[model samples]
Target: MAFVYDLCVVGAGMTGAAAAREASIIDNYKVCLVGPAEPKVRKVNTGKEVFGAHYDEARIASSTSSKVPVWGILAERSIRRYSELEHLSGVHFYDSVGSLTVGTRNSEYLNKVEKQANSQGYAHSMDILDSQQLRRKYPFFNFSSEDQGIAEENTAGIINPRKMVMAQISVASKNGCDVIRETVTGIVRQPDGNSRVVTENGRLIMTRKVLLATNVFTEIHNLLGDIRPLYVPMPQTVTLAEISPQDATRLRNMPSLKYRGYGEPSWPSDYLRNNNDQIDFYMLPPVRYPDGKYYIKLGHSDDILKGPLQVSEMQKWYCGEGDKALEEQMFRLLQRLLPGVTFLSHHGDACITMVTPNSQPYVDLVTPTVGVVMGDNGWAAKSSDEIGRIAARMIVQSDWSYDLPKHMFKLYTNVTGPPPASKL
Candidate 1:
């Protein structure tokens, strides 16, 4: 029988969905997305897919444990991509305000951040701020001169993440790609080299090419080890705290920041993002809490994310319940940061990010029958949409060229040959 589709993308997160949506723009090729059964099914029995929970202190600890340079660089790349993608996806990201850093005089990580910004050709706006200068600019900080600070003006801001993912999926589907909401059970290659995706319902679909944008779970099967893919799944946590419209405005106006950490402060960097009436204080590194447990509720806490910081180490935590625990930590952290705000409802979300060893993404074809775009380390604010468009071009075009920088394809290998000669 003829192949069922030109491409099959596993995972419904930003990467997989982006690949599928963009593929439809090609001439007459049929593309299909074989992903989880449901992207947002909140069944108590069904566990978290890509994201899990946000723990304030644990993540800060996690950040300090490994190479801080990697994280800072990824964040910088994300900042640059924001402007380039806004017009293409019609997604609005708030890139107006600068990010403030409030830490100690000898803060190690923040200085590295400056170096990263400089190396990436983005050091133009970073301003070193003393406590007095910070106070003069925004009195809300409530921090003193004992802290060393820097602000990257017009560098970083927030985007409506879930909404942007949906927009890409919408446009890609409208272009004629078939998006299937199903969990993949296994993958097998036929004699002709086409891939067969076995779904949870036992339905099998065949395709000429395959792309694995599965994020965290991508490593669970042949897609990673056999493919020798350069990716890691790390669980990250962010909190959603409900605030009065007035309180929310305070956070909205305030530039988000990373703080000068306390002991083991490495894992619990304070991140400031906002929901309508609430401020989201996300933490990483999954640390150990005061009670000496992995997670807890309503108490002095310090818990670590039980996973690896590098692609070398990764573990999954069902985030639905952990989300509650993470929210509690974020709220407590927020209370310490901004005492005046009160909360209504609090929730946590786990964002599993695919990270490459070098911190850049993998966007190239590794096999004759497969090409992929994966690994962003959760800096999807701009990279996701742009990467999707890039993946779309690589997968759908006859020439395998659609404006991707030449270096992007060279990342996976040194093979300097012409594009695949086989016709689609």
Candidate 2:
């Protein structure tokens, strides 16, 4: 039977949508997106609601906590792609300014920032400030630390992520592709290279190529194996709280930044981003609310709204009520750090983080018809676009531009060093 489309995408979230859009617009291939018919009633994940929380138990068992992520190197690549997106798709990227990485002098914790910056030659306005110098420059930083900070005044800032995703899809649809919403129920590989995607509604889509950009949802398709760094699927609360003009000014002077060393020697870290309307705080977990129910991005309750992160084996801890514990701890952490900042959320939701054993994502051809695109962490932001581009390149050539070691696909785990072809 003839395939109905050249390429079919599963899932309609940011990654899937972007991939579908790219194949159509960049590759000019006919495409269709399969998922829900409409924005169906989304159930919540109680585990994700755990506002700003972390777990000793979870971290103790984590495989990649004590070291700088090997995958962190991929960020420079994404930045390059973002620089090109405006010209490639007519999408303008607004620079959010640079990032401030805080820590004490002689501290190994803050070294990750230095290492990355030196290797990438990223142009940023930066400074190494003493405790007094740091305190005087930014009034909001009340914490005292013996360590110095490496401020990258250059290339760190925010890119309207939602806008980026939407623009890509818009470009794709305009380029002669169809986007569908249907829950894929089955798959049929025909005698030819084409495949048919069956939906819950008994509808089927046939295509010569299929791309799976369904982040943590890949668990549902039995498509992932025991990869490491072990991504945890938890709810992330991004509260866009309104800041007073005076308060906004104070925050603005501080700029967008990240803190690499504060807590554990090898435990997870936290970061912050200051924007026009609000600032965003990001961490692994220990989130909480005054009422005991976990809230993501500041909402009224404990219900976990189902999004991309799932509750399967690789992502099971967040499927149930894990958020309750995370939220409580997260609040305590925030209270210590932000002292007096009111806790109110405007856009909290759970997200899936693909952490591999070695800090790399699973971007390999699992089968001739299917390729997996899971980010351990780097792909969480800009790398996603590059990932889609990589997939399109693979499908079009039936060959990879970058060569992989013979064992890269054979290894059940991810590695950071000693592998040349493994570079992404």
Candidate 3:
């Protein structure tokens, strides 16, 4: 008898890996995951190549959010499960040194974050700190008198995102998931209603259902038909600053920090402070890099690299170091936050993040046999597990499960209600 995969997940990044792994938990169906071995070489929009978002070295994981209430809940659930997942997978990726969101006193953004935490029933996990307290607790940080801190009490820090994806895929493979490391060329529907997944090397894999977690490439393949129009791809960059091991120790206990800023604008456009005036900065504690030297990582809180791009443009951005001006600004921002620390050298990587019309991700069943988990809005690293869980539940069961607030993540419902007040 020929082997037919019960579920075939394309794009084994964070979301695909998690979805495949979660779905594999059920012993009833044979699952398979397909993705590119090297994402940078993958062809995307306009038939050109671009780098994958998960190719980054690290990503921040925290429960604090100034967006919708459900965002925090999803993040909190995933954050709490990091340890258990690490133990089960025998892979250590989560570095739980804690996290902090620092903003000017009376800042509207900070107020919203507090409200979000309260609504999610995890307010106890957060603590407010005045400028004096912030300086006293984290001496390595340089905070202004007007700044205050929202300190997350537990399960917040930097995560090795690539390794986390590997861990998920590893665990899923061990759970009997067939791992296919290849690019999906096309997905065609069969006469009997099943889907046939075609790979780059002219191979056909039959699957009962298909989950497209291919991120921005969803558009490249037109996976969702009309629904695919809802996602927009934007370039994202992160810079790493090499520092001495002594400086790393000095800032070792420093929590993952988000520096919030507000400009003359009466209103903020996007959630992550992605504006010319309201540009925000985020930092992760120093970690040893491949060169055996400790390096601190930083990136803009704003989706500063806005607008759509062709595959060729994205490929150029990924294969090369990011914008020099942005890197300079990032360095200045970091130096301002920690004046005592000195960066010996700087390096960074560029990738793409798919944004929805709303900031929420699309983790819903597009058709009876087609489910999608895309448009992470740059939050996939921390929340991929929950997003994957929702997708897996959809693939396993005929209806939505009560384990998560599935309705909030529905793509069609979100786009029809109202356009996002601001660009994501």
Candidate 4:
């Protein structure tokens, strides 16, 4: 007789791992986490290979958001637990170097961020810096005269997404949750109120309930049967500029940056045009990659593929190098942002963001026994822990027990022309 799991999570990425761990800890349920490991070698046109956005070394983690106050709330909830998770799993993934947000003084975006910060009581932890103060504090950056900054000097910094996932999975395994390293190909809804998950290697597992954290691949494999959640899988390009160890040490105090609005007027007009006249860019300080080199990473959140990429295009996009022209623009922007910073070499990588209608994550159950926790909208890396917790409680207790309203995460099914405008 096959052992039926109390709950089975269908993605082993950050959210899925956190969900599995939380579910096991909540009630000691028989939990199973399923997903393929990162590809050892990223070769184009490979067979059945899947990728996740958490394969990087550094992601900005902060309790300030320009979109909604709820995001800051979620980030604060997760940031408070980084130490506990690290200690329990014996993994170090977070760095408290701080995070900085800059935009024109009293700009609409900065105002929204300040409002959210105040609502979340994060204003006290942050230092508001005028353009002159910013220049004095961080002499390395080249800020426009009108730019004002809000610096979160504590409780905000960077997280190693890969290591964070590992930490969650490590603790989950210690709690007796089974970890399966295989790609989930399909899910069969049994006649009874249960599910049978089928993997690519011809393995089957039965579970009382299912949670899908599959992100962009949620609909690609038809895991939800005929239910198609409205989402746009847009392609993103991230460029990394390798710097010397001396440069890395000299700039070790650099904080992760979120710069709003078009930068220096000298920047290429085509790049600005491609980004829809918006030049908002987020950057991570020098972080060592797997290749044993330190690189400064930067990417414009709005500079993405024009139309929503189809499921067939994802694999190819992931395999091939990202847009070369965009990469050049990012590298040039990085050079301008940090003058006199020389680079050994630079290259581009590809990733995808799943944007939903409301720019919020969907943490609701599609069916009584099937739940979904996806649609990151570029904010999942920082808030994944709390998001996962909400989903786990929903699955384990079989109720909407979270403080936030359930309708905020309500799932939208079928029919959509283009995703609604995003707040981020």
> TM-scores for all candidates?
0.68, 0.69, 0.90, 0.95
Report per-prediction Cα RMSD to one decimal: 9.4, 9.1, 4.2, 2.2
Between candidates 1 and 3, the one scoring higher on lDDT is 3
Query: Largest TM-score belongs to which candidate?
Result: 4
Model 1 scores what on Cα lDDT?
0.53
lDDT of 2 by residue, 90-193 (tens): 77643534445565466654565566555545524457777777767765554455646665554445455555665566677778778675666566677876
Give model 1's TM-score versus the native structure.
0.68
Tens-digit lDDT track of model 1 for 1-424: 5557988877766666767776777779788877653334444345333332221222210111113243354345444655544555576533344556556666564566566667656667777877688777766545545666666566554444555555566666777778777777677878877888887679898888887776556545545445455444555555545556555455555665665434222223443323221222222211223333332112211124334444323333443434456556665675555555566555565545555555556667666566767766554434455566666666554236644354533334223332333310
For candidate 4, lDDT tens digit of each residue in 188-251?
A: 9888778999999999999999999999998767998888888789888889999999999999
Best by lDDT: 4
**Model 4 RMSD in angstroms:** 2.2
The local distance difference test score of each candidate is: 0.53, 0.48, 0.76, 0.87
Q: How does model 4 fare in lDDT? A: 0.87
Q: CA lDDT of 144 in candidate 4? A: 82
**Please, what are the lDDT tens digits per residue for candidate 3 over residues 1-424?**
5568889998888889999999998977799999876544433343444246777566778888886556677778888788878887999998888889988788898999888888778788788999899889988787777788899857788888888888898899889999988778788898988888988778899999999888777655555555544656777767788899888887778788887765213222333456445558778889886568888888876457755766447666666666666776677667666778988998776677776777787777877888888877877788888888888888777568756566567764333654446523
Order of models, best lDDT first:
4, 3, 1, 2
Worst 10 residues of 4 by lDDT: 415-424
